[model samples]
Target: GIQVEQSPPDLILQEGANSTLRCNFSDSVNNLQWFHQNPWGQLINLFYIPSGTKQNGRLSATTVATERYSLLYISSSQTTDSGVYFCAVGRSSNTGKLIFGQGTTLQVKP
Candidate 1:
Protein backbone atom coordinates (compact mmCIF):
# COMPACT_ATOMS: atom_id res chain seq x y z
CA GLY A 1 0.00 0.00 0.00
CA ILE A 2 1.09 3.54 -0.68
CA GLN A 3 0.29 6.79 1.08
CA VAL A 4 0.52 10.38 -0.08
CA GLU A 5 0.63 13.58 1.93
CA GLN A 6 0.77 17.24 0.95
CA SER A 7 2.08 20.20 2.91
CA PRO A 8 0.68 23.54 3.99
CA PRO A 9 -2.86 22.18 3.36
CA ASP A 10 -3.80 25.70 2.35
CA LEU A 11 -2.24 28.75 0.72
CA ILE A 12 -3.08 32.33 -0.11
CA LEU A 13 -1.40 34.53 -2.67
CA GLN A 14 -1.74 37.78 -4.49
CA GLU A 15 -1.51 38.28 -8.20
CA GLY A 16 2.11 38.17 -9.39
CA ALA A 17 3.25 36.45 -6.23
CA ASN A 18 5.07 33.10 -5.92
CA SER A 19 4.44 29.93 -3.94
CA THR A 20 5.65 26.42 -3.35
CA LEU A 21 3.75 23.24 -2.49
CA ARG A 22 5.03 19.88 -1.39
CA CYS A 23 4.07 16.22 -1.48
CA ASN A 24 5.53 13.28 0.39
CA PHE A 25 4.99 9.58 -0.20
CA SER A 26 5.34 6.70 2.21
CA ASP A 27 6.46 4.00 -0.19
CA SER A 28 8.30 3.41 -3.43
CA VAL A 29 6.33 4.33 -6.51
CA ASN A 30 6.49 3.68 -10.21
CA ASN A 31 5.13 7.05 -11.21
CA LEU A 32 3.67 10.27 -9.87
CA GLN A 33 1.47 13.09 -11.12
CA TRP A 34 0.36 16.53 -9.96
CA PHE A 35 -3.14 17.82 -10.56
CA HIS A 36 -5.20 20.91 -9.99
CA GLN A 37 -8.91 20.73 -9.26
CA ASN A 38 -10.78 23.83 -10.25
CA PRO A 39 -13.86 25.34 -8.66
CA TRP A 40 -15.99 23.38 -11.08
CA GLY A 41 -14.23 20.17 -10.01
CA GLN A 42 -12.40 19.73 -13.29
CA LEU A 43 -9.09 18.02 -12.66
CA ILE A 44 -6.19 19.34 -14.71
CA ASN A 45 -2.98 17.34 -14.90
CA LEU A 46 -0.10 19.63 -14.04
CA PHE A 47 2.94 17.36 -14.18
CA TYR A 48 4.19 13.79 -14.38
CA ILE A 49 7.54 14.26 -12.72
CA PRO A 50 8.45 10.89 -11.34
CA SER A 51 12.11 11.64 -10.73
CA GLY A 52 13.08 14.89 -12.37
CA THR A 53 12.35 18.55 -12.80
CA LYS A 54 9.92 20.10 -15.28
CA GLN A 55 8.37 23.45 -15.94
CA ASN A 56 5.54 24.91 -17.99
CA GLY A 57 4.82 28.56 -18.23
CA ARG A 58 4.58 29.86 -14.65
CA LEU A 59 4.49 26.41 -13.11
CA SER A 60 7.29 23.99 -12.29
CA ALA A 61 7.77 20.71 -10.44
CA THR A 62 10.55 18.56 -9.01
CA THR A 63 10.57 15.03 -7.69
CA VAL A 64 13.33 13.49 -5.59
CA ALA A 65 12.82 9.76 -5.72
CA THR A 66 15.45 8.98 -3.15
CA GLU A 67 13.90 11.41 -0.72
CA ARG A 68 10.39 10.20 -1.57
CA TYR A 69 9.07 13.72 -2.05
CA SER A 70 7.91 16.10 -4.77
CA LEU A 71 7.59 19.86 -5.01
CA LEU A 72 5.47 22.22 -7.11
CA TYR A 73 6.37 25.83 -7.76
CA ILE A 74 4.09 28.55 -9.01
CA SER A 75 5.53 31.86 -10.10
CA SER A 76 3.66 35.10 -10.77
CA SER A 77 0.48 33.60 -9.50
CA GLN A 78 -2.92 34.56 -10.79
CA THR A 79 -6.54 34.17 -9.74
CA THR A 80 -6.89 31.43 -12.33
CA ASP A 81 -4.32 29.45 -10.37
CA SER A 82 -6.56 29.24 -7.33
CA GLY A 83 -7.56 25.67 -6.79
CA VAL A 84 -6.81 22.47 -4.94
CA TYR A 85 -3.52 20.89 -5.92
CA PHE A 86 -3.16 17.16 -5.54
CA CYS A 87 -0.32 14.68 -5.77
CA ALA A 88 -1.02 11.14 -6.86
CA VAL A 89 1.37 8.22 -6.75
CA GLY A 90 1.16 4.90 -8.57
CA ARG A 91 2.37 1.85 -6.75
CA SER A 92 5.13 -0.35 -8.12
CA SER A 93 2.93 -3.45 -8.16
CA ASN A 94 0.80 -2.16 -11.02
CA THR A 95 -2.47 -1.92 -9.18
CA GLY A 96 -3.58 0.65 -11.71
CA LYS A 97 -4.55 2.92 -8.87
CA LEU A 98 -3.21 6.30 -7.88
CA ILE A 99 -3.11 7.19 -4.20
CA PHE A 100 -3.87 10.86 -3.88
CA GLY A 101 -2.85 13.35 -1.25
CA GLN A 102 -5.28 15.49 0.76
CA GLY A 103 -4.46 18.45 -1.47
CA THR A 104 -3.26 22.01 -0.96
CA THR A 105 -5.90 24.61 -1.59
CA LEU A 106 -4.63 27.88 -3.07
CA GLN A 107 -6.44 31.18 -3.13
CA VAL A 108 -5.15 34.04 -5.23
CA LYS A 109 -6.51 37.54 -4.99
CA PRO A 110 -5.97 40.69 -6.96
Candidate 2:
Protein backbone atom coordinates (compact mmCIF):
# COMPACT_ATOMS: atom_id res chain seq x y z
CA GLY A 1 0.00 0.00 0.00
CA ILE A 2 1.12 3.56 -0.69
CA GLN A 3 0.48 6.63 1.43
CA VAL A 4 0.62 10.28 0.43
CA GLU A 5 1.10 13.49 2.38
CA GLN A 6 1.09 17.12 1.40
CA SER A 7 2.78 20.07 3.13
CA PRO A 8 1.72 23.64 3.85
CA PRO A 9 -1.90 22.93 4.66
CA ASP A 10 -2.69 26.51 3.88
CA LEU A 11 -1.01 29.02 1.58
CA ILE A 12 -1.65 32.65 0.73
CA LEU A 13 -0.20 34.07 -2.47
CA GLN A 14 -0.59 37.48 -3.96
CA GLU A 15 -1.49 37.79 -7.57
CA GLY A 16 1.55 37.28 -9.76
CA ALA A 17 3.47 35.64 -6.93
CA ASN A 18 5.11 32.26 -7.20
CA SER A 19 4.88 29.30 -4.86
CA THR A 20 5.72 25.65 -4.59
CA LEU A 21 3.68 22.81 -3.07
CA ARG A 22 5.19 19.57 -1.90
CA CYS A 23 3.98 15.98 -1.63
CA ASN A 24 5.69 13.03 0.03
CA PHE A 25 4.86 9.40 -0.29
CA SER A 26 5.40 6.61 2.19
CA ASP A 27 6.14 3.77 -0.20
CA SER A 28 7.18 3.12 -3.76
CA VAL A 29 4.53 4.06 -6.27
CA ASN A 30 4.00 3.19 -9.88
CA ASN A 31 1.85 6.21 -10.70
CA LEU A 32 1.77 9.79 -9.39
CA GLN A 33 -0.62 12.57 -10.24
CA TRP A 34 -1.33 16.12 -9.15
CA PHE A 35 -4.83 17.54 -8.91
CA HIS A 36 -6.49 20.85 -8.16
CA GLN A 37 -9.82 20.82 -6.40
CA ASN A 38 -11.68 24.00 -7.17
CA PRO A 39 -13.79 25.92 -4.69
CA TRP A 40 -16.75 24.08 -6.15
CA GLY A 41 -15.08 20.77 -5.42
CA GLN A 42 -14.36 19.88 -9.00
CA LEU A 43 -11.17 17.94 -9.39
CA ILE A 44 -8.91 18.93 -12.24
CA ASN A 45 -5.83 17.00 -13.26
CA LEU A 46 -2.72 19.13 -13.25
CA PHE A 47 -0.04 16.62 -14.08
CA TYR A 48 0.85 12.93 -14.09
CA ILE A 49 4.55 13.04 -13.52
CA PRO A 50 5.70 9.67 -12.27
CA SER A 51 9.31 10.77 -12.68
CA GLY A 52 11.11 13.76 -14.07
CA THR A 53 9.67 17.26 -14.56
CA LYS A 54 6.92 18.71 -16.67
CA GLN A 55 5.58 22.21 -17.29
CA ASN A 56 2.38 23.59 -18.69
CA GLY A 57 1.83 27.32 -18.89
CA ARG A 58 2.59 28.81 -15.46
CA LEU A 59 2.40 25.47 -13.68
CA SER A 60 5.03 22.79 -13.43
CA ALA A 61 5.68 19.59 -11.49
CA THR A 62 8.61 17.39 -10.65
CA THR A 63 8.74 13.91 -9.15
CA VAL A 64 11.80 12.21 -7.75
CA ALA A 65 10.94 8.57 -7.42
CA THR A 66 14.19 7.79 -5.68
CA GLU A 67 13.33 10.24 -2.91
CA ARG A 68 9.60 9.44 -2.85
CA TYR A 69 8.59 13.07 -3.12
CA SER A 70 7.06 15.42 -5.65
CA LEU A 71 6.82 19.17 -6.11
CA LEU A 72 4.26 21.39 -7.77
CA TYR A 73 5.39 24.88 -8.73
CA ILE A 74 3.03 27.65 -9.62
CA SER A 75 4.32 30.85 -11.20
CA SER A 76 2.35 34.08 -11.69
CA SER A 77 -0.46 33.18 -9.38
CA GLN A 78 -3.98 34.27 -10.16
CA THR A 79 -7.34 34.36 -8.39
CA THR A 80 -8.27 31.26 -10.26
CA ASP A 81 -5.48 29.43 -8.53
CA SER A 82 -7.32 29.69 -5.24
CA GLY A 83 -8.17 26.11 -4.41
CA VAL A 84 -6.93 22.91 -2.85
CA TYR A 85 -4.04 21.10 -4.47
CA PHE A 86 -3.82 17.34 -3.95
CA CYS A 87 -1.21 14.73 -4.69
CA ALA A 88 -2.32 11.21 -5.54
CA VAL A 89 -0.35 8.02 -5.96
CA GLY A 90 -1.28 4.58 -7.17
CA ARG A 91 0.43 1.36 -6.21
CA SER A 92 1.38 -1.33 -8.68
CA SER A 93 -1.65 -3.40 -7.75
CA ASN A 94 -4.09 -0.61 -8.48
CA THR A 95 -4.95 0.07 -12.07
CA GLY A 96 -6.65 3.46 -11.84
CA LYS A 97 -7.53 4.21 -8.25
CA LEU A 98 -5.34 6.74 -6.43
CA ILE A 99 -4.49 7.44 -2.82
CA PHE A 100 -4.87 11.16 -2.12
CA GLY A 101 -3.29 13.27 0.56
CA GLN A 102 -5.02 15.86 2.70
CA GLY A 103 -4.10 18.60 0.23
CA THR A 104 -2.62 22.11 0.24
CA THR A 105 -5.14 24.88 0.11
CA LEU A 106 -3.95 27.93 -1.80
CA GLN A 107 -5.52 31.36 -1.68
CA VAL A 108 -4.45 33.73 -4.40
CA LYS A 109 -5.65 37.21 -3.60
CA PRO A 110 -5.77 40.07 -6.01
Candidate 3:
Protein backbone atom coordinates (compact mmCIF):
# COMPACT_ATOMS: atom_id res chain seq x y z
CA GLY A 1 0.00 0.00 0.00
CA ILE A 2 1.16 3.50 -0.74
CA GLN A 3 0.23 6.86 0.76
CA VAL A 4 0.35 10.10 -1.18
CA GLU A 5 0.32 13.70 -0.01
CA GLN A 6 0.49 17.11 -1.68
CA SER A 7 1.96 20.18 -0.15
CA PRO A 8 0.56 23.75 0.26
CA PRO A 9 -3.00 22.36 0.02
CA ASP A 10 -3.89 25.51 -1.93
CA LEU A 11 -2.27 28.12 -4.16
CA ILE A 12 -3.24 31.38 -5.77
CA LEU A 13 -1.39 33.07 -8.58
CA GLN A 14 -1.73 35.91 -10.98
CA GLU A 15 -1.60 35.35 -14.67
CA GLY A 16 2.00 35.20 -15.92
CA ALA A 17 3.27 34.11 -12.55
CA ASN A 18 5.16 30.94 -11.91
CA SER A 19 4.68 28.33 -9.23
CA THR A 20 5.90 24.97 -8.02
CA LEU A 21 3.74 22.15 -6.68
CA ARG A 22 5.03 19.22 -4.68
CA CYS A 23 3.91 15.64 -4.08
CA ASN A 24 5.24 13.11 -1.62
CA PHE A 25 4.60 9.42 -1.34
CA SER A 26 5.23 6.77 1.23
CA ASP A 27 6.80 3.47 0.16
CA SER A 28 7.89 2.48 -3.33
CA VAL A 29 5.73 2.73 -6.40
CA ASN A 30 6.08 1.40 -9.91
CA ASN A 31 3.88 4.06 -11.53
CA LEU A 32 3.70 7.77 -10.75
CA GLN A 33 1.18 10.09 -12.37
CA TRP A 34 0.15 13.73 -12.36
CA PHE A 35 -3.28 15.01 -13.32
CA HIS A 36 -5.28 18.19 -13.38
CA GLN A 37 -8.97 18.26 -12.48
CA ASN A 38 -10.81 21.15 -14.04
CA PRO A 39 -13.58 23.16 -12.41
CA TRP A 40 -16.14 21.20 -14.39
CA GLY A 41 -14.61 17.98 -13.02
CA GLN A 42 -12.73 16.89 -16.08
CA LEU A 43 -9.60 14.98 -15.22
CA ILE A 44 -6.75 15.70 -17.62
CA ASN A 45 -3.62 13.61 -17.72
CA LEU A 46 -0.54 15.73 -17.19
CA PHE A 47 2.37 13.37 -16.76
CA TYR A 48 3.50 9.84 -15.89
CA ILE A 49 6.88 10.07 -14.23
CA PRO A 50 7.91 6.93 -12.43
CA SER A 51 11.32 8.51 -12.16
CA GLY A 52 13.29 11.31 -13.74
CA THR A 53 11.92 14.53 -15.24
CA LYS A 54 9.56 15.56 -18.01
CA GLN A 55 8.53 18.85 -19.55
CA ASN A 56 5.57 19.85 -21.69
CA GLY A 57 4.86 23.38 -22.82
CA ARG A 58 4.75 25.56 -19.72
CA LEU A 59 4.66 22.63 -17.36
CA SER A 60 7.37 20.30 -16.13
CA ALA A 61 7.67 17.54 -13.56
CA THR A 62 10.41 15.74 -11.74
CA THR A 63 10.24 12.57 -9.71
CA VAL A 64 12.91 11.26 -7.42
CA ALA A 65 11.72 7.74 -6.80
CA THR A 66 14.56 7.02 -4.44
CA GLU A 67 13.37 9.87 -2.20
CA ARG A 68 9.68 9.15 -2.73
CA TYR A 69 8.77 12.67 -3.87
CA SER A 70 7.81 14.52 -7.00
CA LEU A 71 7.45 18.13 -8.13
CA LEU A 72 5.40 19.91 -10.77
CA TYR A 73 6.40 23.28 -12.18
CA ILE A 74 4.08 25.75 -13.81
CA SER A 75 5.55 28.70 -15.64
CA SER A 76 3.65 31.82 -16.69
CA SER A 77 0.37 30.81 -15.17
CA GLN A 78 -2.94 31.48 -16.82
CA THR A 79 -6.61 31.63 -15.84
CA THR A 80 -7.14 28.37 -17.65
CA ASP A 81 -4.70 26.76 -15.25
CA SER A 82 -7.00 27.09 -12.30
CA GLY A 83 -7.82 23.62 -11.02
CA VAL A 84 -6.85 20.86 -8.66
CA TYR A 85 -3.57 19.08 -9.35
CA PHE A 86 -3.28 15.49 -8.24
CA CYS A 87 -0.50 12.96 -7.82
CA ALA A 88 -1.27 9.27 -7.94
CA VAL A 89 0.95 6.26 -7.52
CA GLY A 90 0.48 2.55 -8.10
CA ARG A 91 2.22 -0.41 -6.55
CA SER A 92 1.84 -2.45 -9.73
CA SER A 93 2.97 -0.76 -12.89
CA ASN A 94 0.34 -2.31 -15.12
CA THR A 95 -2.51 -1.83 -12.70
CA GLY A 96 -4.72 1.21 -13.06
CA LYS A 97 -5.56 1.21 -9.39
CA LEU A 98 -3.59 3.93 -7.63
CA ILE A 99 -3.54 5.93 -4.41
CA PHE A 100 -4.31 9.60 -5.00
CA GLY A 101 -3.18 12.59 -3.06
CA GLN A 102 -5.58 15.16 -1.66
CA GLY A 103 -4.53 17.49 -4.46
CA THR A 104 -3.31 21.07 -4.61
CA THR A 105 -6.02 23.50 -5.56
CA LEU A 106 -4.59 26.19 -7.83
CA GLN A 107 -6.26 29.46 -8.74
CA VAL A 108 -4.78 31.60 -11.42
CA LYS A 109 -6.30 35.04 -11.38
CA PRO A 110 -6.46 37.32 -14.32
Query: What lDDT does each candidate get?
Result: 0.93, 0.94, 0.95
Estimate, for each residue in 3-109, the C-alpha lDDT of model 2 and write its tens digit.
78899999998999999999999988888999999999999999988899999999999999999999999999999999999999987535488899999999999
Candidate 3, 29: how far from true, in Å? 0.7
Q: Which candidate tops lDDT?
A: 3
Cα lDDT of model 1 by residue, 1-110, tens digit: 78899999999998999999999999888789999999999999999888989999999999999899999999999999999999999965353688999999999999
Ranking, lDDT, top scorer first:
3, 2, 1
Per-residue CA lDDT of model 3 for 37-63, tens digit only, reads: 999999999999999999999999999
- Model 2: CA > 4 A from native: 93-95
TM-score of each: 0.95, 0.95, 0.97
lDDT score of residue 106 within candidate 1: 99
Model 1 misplacement above 4 A:
92-95
**Predicted structure 3, TM vs. truth:** 0.97
